[model samples]
Target: MLERIREGSQGPLAMTIVGLIIISFAVTGVGSYLGSSTSEAAAVVNGEDITVQEVEVAYQNQRARMEQQFGEQIASAFANETYLANFKSQVLEQLISEKLVEQKANEMGLRVSDEQIKEAIFDIDAFKIAGQFDNDTFKAILQRQGFTAVSFRDYMRQQMTTEQLSTALTASSFSLEDEVAEVLKLQQQKRDAQTLEVNAADFAGDIELSDEEINDYYQANLSNFDTQEEVKLAYVSLSVEDLMANESVTEEEARQNYQDNIAAYQTIEERRVSHILIEFGDDEAAAESKAEAVLAMVNEADADFATIAAAESADIVSAEEGGDLDYIVKGDWSESFEEAVFGLEKVGDTTGLVKTEFGFHIIKLTDLKPQVTTPFEEVQEELTALLLKDKATDTFFSLQEEIASAAFESPDSLEEVSNISGRPIIQTAFFSSGNYPASVNYPQVENVAFSSELIDDKVNSDILQVNDEKILVVRVAEHKPQRTLALEEVKASITTQLSAEKTQQAALDWTEALKQKLLNGESVYDTLAAKSLEWNEVSGIERFASSLPSEMTKSIFSLAPAAGQDVDVVSLANGNVGLVKLTAVEAVDEIKAEDIEATLQGLANNNSRQSYDSFVAALVDEATIERITR
Candidate 1:
């Protein structure tokens, strides 16, 4: 029963266990296992034991995730001996880290209060409505996730506590204003640069290869020349789409169904209304006086509503339309406005001053539409088409299973099955392992085609159920094996690569020579121009860092700007080299007041988190962790 309950929901078991542990800790001032006896201590940090049952629960929860994502076949492979070893190592590391962090949190006396937990929960958007916390919504969400209110709140509380612990440990790591200014300057800077690309084609014509060498290379790689075994497949798919196309429903039935469930399709009566809004300033007396003046003019007819709206209405959007608002359905407008609009009995009828969340408004109803029920006769054709399609789909899949069974037993051809089932058999040309044909998007069809048995020998697959109304059967007519390329077929390509390598070496040597000349008191621009190489400069380059392109920005910024000193050469992963020198350094622009406040808050949060992480790391280092794997 418990297994069934757990399986019915997609929520992770680890989260549930963590929530339970937190609740236990909160209630008893120490953690204890509540679910089962499998909870034995797994590790210890400064006499604080990490339970074995807790680790197992976490592991199972993670394994379930792997199973859900990759399916049973791949999940089994991942759970095997080799993969399990790696998984164990990762699990142990995480456990150790958590223990270390917890121990540090204890040493620092970091704690979370009930009031803080309640505040955090209320602040979470998921539990709020209309800018306020809604207990019903929170309970509904917990129920949907198979969690009790207590369990859900415990989970939230634990997360908040963990955050608190982190903040305590890392609060001191934040930098001063000068450091932040320097960082900001680097972030906002930009570089204007140009590159001189030396093409491989420039050296391609200079390289030559001998026939003898080519022949020797081909002889050493004969397997590369062998043709891969390619396969053609013959298969049949059945889907409800064909059945649905053929089925039909009568007019009488359509009308009856519509009458029986009129509320399901009936739209609410709505009105197209518009209004002239008069917004009040912060001063209550002034706002009231303005409202009274606008109301008196509207009531006296001295000024027409549309003309007055155009001249003085604060809601410019509706005022420009002569206070014309489009048709609005129930719940579309604010409560007071909606009530006033719906209360009108005739078009062009104006309402008394109405107050809503937006402001004061004098509304005029322009148009009205009464709710109407659609007649069954009017929708008969649609109903008929839907019924026909559903019938055709049922017939299609019913015939599919019979055809698949016959084809699988015969092992000779799909012709017999096609004739018996009266369904057309389609054929595919040679396809590679990773290639997915447009028709193979159906999971059942693709799975059958990729099966080892079907690929190895010409065999028909069993009827595969894709959905309730769809089934497929496939047979392999050909097989293909991947092969390498022979040297003779690729010799020209190799020669081109070799030539490009030599050209790159020559360019590097030239660059080096220019560097030495600069070091010997020669102007970099003059030395480069002497060799017909042009020099370019990039200014205000940002101090960006990334591993991609092999840290080009870092290398560029690392260069010194001392006069007569050659910039250190930096190599790129793409076989390019560059030399850079800093031109100038400047502080960041003045920070805005709001921006300064935001920065301070962000810095404080980051510092807290860092401290917490360091504390955790320390605890993990001092702890004894053991793993008993099955």
Candidate 2:
């Protein structure tokens, strides 16, 4: 069912195991199928219509997800029309890719049975409660993820079918022993090198920039000097928790409500049973006959069930304990076995041979707690709290509707909303898109505050969910549009930047002249004396060693040791230059067997991923995809 779909392969071909269930937070309720003819196609893949409604649904889901994770950085991007269009376009492209895969799978005759889909659903951990599958929990979780039972099943079948296709595409990669040993040797290799340093700041004192240069550079890059547009929001924040204190359930109402749903508050009886299991192997009839013989022996007048179980039961772990299985509820065991267990009248009562996947089981009722209905006096307070919570939730939703309507109708300000909902208008200090006030810390509030509807149009925003219990509606109270900073305000920083650029260029030019001298085999000890540069020699450093600058290390390693002594100039990260000289390279002759195997597996996985990418690329090229703007 839900096999380890991405067990080793690492590429788009590995799609994702979540794709197996479409356990989606980014795409709401998108199944692999077309809608009715009246539905409009946003794109067509192999003549299959991906409806405009599907794209919009997936887009909203993705947008909500993006706003939650990346709001601080990309909050302003959402206000840009081009960014919104591109975001929606990405959603459409993903749908088109999925459609192509579905078409290809259909052409290949790949399929998943309904029974397989059921098994997969039952196996999902999200759908389980107390380590057992609960139908209500399954349905609730599915509803939250935007799926009906039928649609999820269809989606599962499509995903599992595609999984089968994905597995086939990368199933053929392998590694040779020699290639693995060679890789292991290289991984153990170390290199020795030396670098002559040239610091840019050391040359800065000799360079100077004029005001004319600074002004010219600033004039050409005005956009870089523009301030980020900011806003102050006037909003009403409401919470269900704030309304809970006002809600109360009377004793009589609690009592009557408890009476109506008493079954829900009662604990289920659990049966603790033990069984002597007889496993069916090559001869099923023989095993069944043996199971019946064991059952007869346990039923004898003077027989000890424990003694017989320990002597003959095929279930080794339970057999050692005289077949003592712990407490179990109705769904814990298979249907045929459950029926036999539940049918037993009392403790010490034994059942006839029960046929199951494990074979036959002679089950004996060890103990049970009878189902108990909790008295109203004992649970009266709990029931009252629940009733009050229900009342509060209902009142909260009603108040939320009032706020939403008033906020939308009275777009100029939150005064109408404050009057209707009785929540006072809150003002936030001026905050940029990323930095926000504690009262309105939610991404939804931040996004709406920066949105055009609230800022440009000066209209109230749609009610935004701060959390399950809280919501916010906002409009920009003050708007500050982006403006270029004057040259006087930014003159000193521009001068410093231009000075650093000149110094860095000087360092590069100096390194090149030294590199040519080193290449001609002139001794570096004497060369350093002439220009005040010295070598930072490091001995036996590995390829990835951090003792030297990373750029210098990489340049040093790139040199072929077989090519004899070499020199290369490197641009260091800290505004400096590096003239690296490779001295020697060493590779260990021995590596452990486990290290070899691990290296081999890693290389093979890389090869497999590349192969899978090629396969998908080929399929994508073969497919005919049309992008429709309308």
Candidate 3:
């Protein structure tokens, strides 16, 4: 029962908590500047100080996650002043909300034990190796994400507590019968529609825009023609590959490593076992007596063991497959089951009735695989490669600091760093600050290159970690200021834009006239059909039907009248005008059981989300939050 409860709703709560802790957005990494601020407090929530360093760390962590998820191009877009301000505001709000939630949890006497936190952490797939939690992997991941053991454990505790609060809140918000009925009514209601599609391309040929119109559009939207500021960077990057090119592992070192970790190469013994279970339901005596009888039958020399097991075994899943459980290593099964299977020495050996929590099992040892290890000579190459990589990683880190220090000391050029670190000075072509060179795909390089300090002071930017194995040190070679393109230079582009705008307007005008005509009980279907603009009759489509196009469905379902009701002209995403008319509307009285369940579940989820949002909103309104920094 405890296991069932623990596994209930699976790991969504933990995932949700993690998402809250590290909310991803472009507004991240801007907090890095706050790390050095004299004012420690970034914000104060109910007299509690939210430190600048905390915001910086959160920003950096979330930025790294965003960079990884969306790559440098998308991440770089968020580096602008406006986006950063918005991002910081969002981050602060999230932090405040988290504090409020944590305070609420404390007030409610919610307590998450160390054991529970450990269990939650261990359950995370990211920290798992071979299906079990790995301590080293956990530490490594935390380190990569800029977290310490103490901080991460506290984070987990807070997350778990908040999750408990959330679970309670969601569970408390029950699905109302009326709400479900309304949802069912909406879902079940069907509309028959006739659609007329007007292609924008058809009207484009008829659109002729005057130069006055084009000039007006271009003049009004001058910002669109303005080019972004660009920079050319000269930098030197250090990677494990750079070290690996020169690094080599001696035979002696490889042999020593092989000897030290020999167990890693050795295969563990495995057993293939089949079993027949007789569960003790109401009558334990009857179950035990049946298991004993099955064991006796299996012990017979000519007994069809699989046939008997399939016919009589209470474990339905295994029974259907003739009770054949494939090869399993040690620690893969329950203790009693493992003990019973491992105790049987020879193939075809059957165990007597062995009782466990589930039931009594008549176990048969079907097969066994002996432990084996590959010869040292066969794995010598593999071991050498591994050792070389490890050596390269160590060398890369040691030299990374040296290169960064050298680059910073001589920011005007990478020549000094190249000479000091024995790395080549690489220069990039002039690229817009936001649109970086495809080859130099590091986010840190872009951040440093575009930084005001680097551009104005012309100082060597900080040595930035590109990834675990890569480090970059960059200096700006040339900076190009933002500029606006002249009217004549963008005249061709302006003409095309104006033409498309005029065409789209014409299409909308034509669509509106047709819609009005349809509302007045006029049949233009014959006229449209003559021009191959035939009206497609869509019938009995529900709100969420995939058969009809989404735009059509939206336009059709929005109608209230049973007879022809002209819907608003839909300007489709594909630059086509869609005019729709409701031909018929049908109301469904009897909803299917599955439909009801799905609708109710959706309503319950939506209600729970709203409740959580409202709860957070209420907390914020009650708490006195003060911004300490702009």
Candidate 4:
């Protein structure tokens, strides 16, 4: 289901859904029970409320990921009003789509049992240690991700149910072989070309920038130069691990825990056996005769059972291994097979022909292991650690309540909670929206640090849960307001910008003039010779070649001119211009089998995705969705 969500690429809405899946694990009903009224809802899908906080959290998480990927440049990009608005809309739409999917899944009667949820959690690589599920590792990771055992289980159940729905929708998507072949031909076709290029810098020096133009430009876009609001914060945190470090479990406690969970130490008796089978197909009598003969050989003096079984057994899987069936406990095999295997009382014992659904079997018992209990002394260390953790969990929650109460009662400072919880108060350097201090990574921290209440009234923030075992209370220590730069302070920057604009316009103007001259019976070679620019000769180049400029290739391949009128104007990516002339085109009549196979796979995948996308779109259109808040 997660992979299917990520595979969608129709629009920003699809990508937003993928981003939400990456950043969000579980959130209660869209409105988060902030209020009974729909006024606080970010959206309402089929009358189900989506809260403002939910959308904000999703948007903030997406912004954090973008900032991490692109650094300071992403912050600048977010400053654009248009981009920010579009992004928020897309995020809200994604939340609505999620709710729709969940509703559809429920309507379809999709369900995930407790056992399935447990298996899925165990299969997750994040919760595994050394390729197997470890309780300690699983708990620690869930705690770090702000999930309790119950909540994480619920999350996994929801994920599994949704996956069932997704699988059903996309199971029948495919593509035809001929469609794939056609795409391969088009994608592999190559073309040849030659071009004369012009650089924008050549004309930039000729165009001049005026003081009036620079002043007007700077005054018109003042928001571009404004600084973002920033704040400094002081906070105190309580951690469960810190309490566990000083807590210990005595031998008495360990013994009591072991006694309380004594059933976990019990094991069942198991057996190891081998068998030679004569399968009963069309002739049951023949099978019985062969089994009788094998049994006779086993009973004969100096007769090796393994050699006879290997040469005569119809069970090919175990024949090479001397008919070794490894190990078996009760409920591990068929009723008849189980009865026969356990009937033997001692090792090296053989049973007479045993009848089963598969055939007649000559059974030999090789080993037996009786049920046993692990002594308390052998598991004392493990028990002690478990008891200590349980005690720490109890103490941790107790401290959390105490600290929250103290912080709320004394809002002026965190000193009371810090002393009561034994956690020192910490301060962060100044930071702003979309740009946070490395030490402070939580979105709630930034939100509280910059709120009007924190800045204007200077009150302590409400206790915020950073994770399953960590809680924080923050207060603002300093504040900085937004500011805009004056024209005098940004005159040089404006001048540089205006110069680039003039140069681009001048280059476009020059290209237009050259194009008109070519259209009016001017020779391309003669014009380039007069202009003292060399022509780059390219032959048999691909439409998607990296050797030539992307804009040049796009223009050359968009449409071909008549045989004698192949000259066309193209814009280069470096704010320059180009005069491209198509020379020749080549067609590939055949492709390698491997290439065709790869192309076919890609086409099938894309077609399946398109079908799935259409299904989702149709679901959305039929649903009643309303924007209650923006």
* Top-lDDT candidate index: 2
Best by TM-score: 2
The TM-score, computed over Cα atoms with residue i paired to residue i, of candidate 4 is 0.52
Task: List model 1 lDDT by residue over 485-519, tens digit each.
Answer: 65656888655545566656655665666567766
lDDT of 4 by residue, 24-92 (tens): 443322222122344468888898888887787668767876787798656655655557888999998
Worst 10 contiguous positions by lDDT, candidate 2: 1-10
**Candidate 4 clashing pairs?**
30-50, 30-51, 31-51
What are the lDDT figures for the candidates, one per model? 0.62, 0.78, 0.77, 0.76
- Comparing 1 and 3 by TM-score, which wins? 3
TM-score ranking, best first: 2, 3, 1, 4
What is the per-residue lDDT of model 3 for residues 1-630, given as tens digits with 9 covering 90 to 100?
223323432466655554444323212322232233464888888887778777767666666777788896657656455667778778778878988988887777676678766666776767679999899997877665556777667766666766677766776667766667777888779888777788888888888888898889888999999988888888877778777878888899988888899888899989887889899999999999888888888878899878988998998888887788889888988897888888888998888888888999888888999789877899999889888899989887787667777776766777877776677878899988567786576556655677899889988877777667777778788898889999999999999877777888899998888777777879877757755798788888889898866787888888777445546688877777888878788887776777768777887888889999999999999999988865
* Off by more than 4 A, model 3: 1-172, 248-379, 390-412, 415-439, 456-462, 523-526, 529-532, 546-549, 562-568, 627-630
lDDT of 1 at 76: 42
For every model shown, what is its TM-score relative to the native structure?
Answer: 0.55, 0.63, 0.59, 0.52
Could you tell which candidate, 1 or 3, scores higher by lDDT?
Answer: 3
- Candidates 3 and 4 compared: the better one by lDDT is 3
Q: Write the per-residue lDDT of candidate 2 for residues 543-563, one digit (tens) a residue.
A: 778888899888887887644
